[model samples]
Target: MSRDRQRLLDYLVHILEAIARIERYVDDLDEVGFLTDELTQDAVIRNLEIIGEASNNIDKYYPEFSAQHDHVPFASAYEMRNALAHGYFRVDLEVVWKTLEKDLPELGLSVDKLIRQLMDENSGL
Candidate 1:
């Protein structure tokens, strides 16, 4: 992998780790509702933004990757991240909760697949 791809992968790992942490704290409606506080929500949203930014960078470096993975929802992920980063004041906790419960897991799995692909390619596997 190129240096840029490595960096992006690092960021992707960070995003995954952050998501795992948030997931540990939230397993049901009560936990999710309780974590609606600004600090906790902001941390989760920020990690998502980091994930989106890393994915965007990967797309720029490897357009073929983007082409092969068009269904990954990269643009929507970035847009949601942008909203969280720039419009935190207006961010809806329910939306964040829904995304964490739905989108993040799928995104994490996709990212892991991409990372594995990159590694296998680099290793000539």
Candidate 2:
């Protein structure tokens, strides 16, 4: 594989790892527990930041790939990262909880699929 493809694969792997970490961090926590546990909240938010950073890198370095895979919310993830990184006080835990509950699983699936597709394409090449 070319260096660019390898880098992109690294980013995808980082995203998947972050997602898994977030899942494990919140595995047993309800909304209330998540909100109340500052450590877990911090861990989750940090992983989210990682996801957004990886997404941003993918968009920057692999614009064509990002454009083609419009199903992945690369822009949105980066935007959310900006919000969390810049304005921690304004973060609404309720929304975070909702995102965790609803959006993350789907995001994980999409990213996993992308990783597999990328690997398969590389193998063919």
Candidate 3:
């Protein structure tokens, strides 16, 4: 495998790990519970930053891959990361909760699928 492909895989793995961490952090919490818990909110936001950083790295280092996998929301991930990391004062818990409930699962699945596809293509499986 090329070094770039390996790096891409690494970024994908990072995103998956972040997604899992976010899921675990919010396990049984409802929106209200998540809103009330500063610790969990911080944890979730940190993982989200990780996801955004990884996505940004992938988009930067592998434009072709990012272009091909248009469904993965690579741009959105990084944009959200900027918002969460740099604009924390303006962060809305309700929007964050909605993203957690609706977007993360789909993003996780999309990333997982891309990782598997890359592995399969490389291994001839």
Candidate 4:
């Protein structure tokens, strides 16, 4: 694998790990109840930051791959990451909750598919 591809794979691994952590943390909580706990909120936000960061790396290190997966929203993830990492008060917990509850599962699936695609490409090479 190219070094950039390997680094992209590393970032993807982090993204997947973060997604799994968020899943485990929020599996039992409802939306209203989810943001009420400080620990869960922090955990979720941190994982979100990780996802955004990974998305950014994928865009940077593997531009063609990122461009191919236009549905993944790499730019939006960077925007979200910037919000989470820089502007604490700007974060709408409800939005965060909604994202976790709705968007994350689909994101996970997309990212997993991306990993498989990369791996398949590497194997062929």
TM-scores, one per candidate: 0.79, 0.96, 0.97, 0.92
Please tell me which predicted candidate would have the highest TM-score against the true structure: 3
lDDT of each: 0.73, 0.93, 0.94, 0.88
C-alpha lDDT (0 to 100) for residue 85 of candidate 3: 98
Pull out the clashing pairs in model 3: none
Top-scoring candidate (lDDT): 3
Off by over 4 Å in 1: 25-32
In candidate 2 the C-alpha lDDT for residue 2 amounts to 86
Candidate 4 lDDT, tens digit per residue, 1-125?
99877888889888889999999999999987787888899888999999998899888878897888889987787788899989877779998988887888998998888888889999994
The clash count for each model shown is 0, 0, 0, 0
Instruction: Please provide, for model 3 over 22-105, each residue's C-alpha lDDT reduced to its tens digit, 9 standing for 90 to 100.
Output: 999999999999999999999999999999999999999899889988988999999999999998678888899999999999
How far residue 29's Cα lies from its native spot in candidate 2, in Å, is 0.8
TM-score of 3: 0.97
Candidate 3 stretches with Cα past 4 Å from truth are: none
Model 4: lDDT of residue 29: 94
